[model samples]
Target: MAKRAPGLGAVQETMLITLHARARCGDEAAARLVEAIDYDFAPMQRNAGATELFHVLRCAALDEWTRQFLAECPHGTVVELGAGLSTRADRLDNGTAHWCYVDLPDATELRRALLPDGERRRTITGSVLEDGWADAVAADPGPYLFLAEGVLVYLEPAGVRRALTTVATRFPGCRVALDTHGEWIVKRSRGPLTRMAADLVWACEDPKALQDWDLGLTLRESWPLSRPDWVVRRALPRHTRLTLAAVNAFVPRRMTNSRVNLYSVDATG
Candidate 1:
């Protein structure tokens, strides 16, 4: 468990819990992160609208993906950017493999209190835009998976481009999976939720532009929340595949399909 300290914000604390929860099923590292945090996550998680349901759903999808990846990529290294208290290591830890949790210095300081630090499933603290961090990661030679989660959009386009290029050039056979916001969603919406989202991260006009930047547009899957086939997909996690299918049959067409951009970077240079 992580040792506790003062000055950590509740919002950051909650984000950590989300990561741990996603890692709960098979991610022992994630579970350890939860137990390590000094703050209470119940207030945010249990509340009606404190945390976004869709975010949790996204976490579910990623958790499933992480487990499947570990099964297929033994000895491959996995790196989590902006790894705020996320125990993805707990969920995807392979004793023989390497896992690097990277983030900013302040967040790293806070994370150190909640996570164990050392090589082999280690944590690297630095701004994702910086060159030094990439240089360090480039030292690891193996099939790598860069899991950015909800972090890509926070970076300006140049930073995002540089980071991806750096990784692709340094590591061979590396893949990345991350979420993105639609340009339309950002420009058209003026509601409270829209503004709140903008306050949290920068917006992009086109997610598909990733390919132009040399990042392979691997699997462009959409998690449409309002389609006839959406409900069952969400329900299948608890092995409620049948229930999810049943619900999908009756779902409406008007629901918002928040666009998620996932890319797979090939690091074979």
Candidate 2:
């Protein structure tokens, strides 16, 4: 029998994409589940080298941020918009915090299939574009944290704007960590790195524009997402390694491919 093709539906594709990334980095759950998804993803998994390493590192950074948020707001609620198949709640679980994984109905079904709901964790079938999901999250006591990883880039500029403003308006004292592409990638829609995944139709060259949304959002940090040092030393070609070093040394901000931005919403938006 021929190998089954990987499913590439919206939202569902990201689950596979992130799973491939984690499995490539030897995440046991990701590794075990990849094959069980009914496809031979070995070729895609093999190609995951640097991209996988960077994604895994990005996830680690988010996990750390969540840890800090939990420490500060011990009973905080976390809402993961476009949750896909992420195990972040499991990875970042504090004993008291509540987690809601929000996504379209289909994706939520897949999420529920893989991970059972617990006392503190539940999956909600809904879109961030809609209103009720956030309200449900608000019903729980919170100093909230929202994650939009690999999500906003797919939304149009207006949709992204509305989503951000809505969060600020509805959940004051919330923190959001989202991934975005630079204008170059958004306009060209053709980069070696981005070409590996689904096309990212939305991009923001100036994160400062987001602040101007009049949503009372503070740009806490916007950092380039890159492969870890050990991954570079171990896996990258010699010239690629040299090029990365030069970029980091001379023009770090020119890293326009990928970024993970963290923002804080004002209590009086």
Total clashing pairs for each candidate:
9, 0
lDDT of all the models against the reference?
0.58, 0.72
TM-score per model over all chains: 0.71, 0.83
Model 1: how large is the Cα RMSD against the reference? Answer: 5.1
lDDT per residue for candidate 1 within 124-221, as digits (tens), equals 87777765677666666566777776666556778778777766666646667666565544344432233223333446545566777655545544
lDDT of 2 by residue, 61-155 (tens): 67667888899998988888888778776566779999988888777776676676889888888777777787777778888999987788888
Candidate 2 Cα lDDT to native: 0.72
Q: Worst ten-residue run, lDDT, model 2?
A: 188-197
Provide the lDDT at 61 for model 1. Answer: 58
Best by TM-score: 2
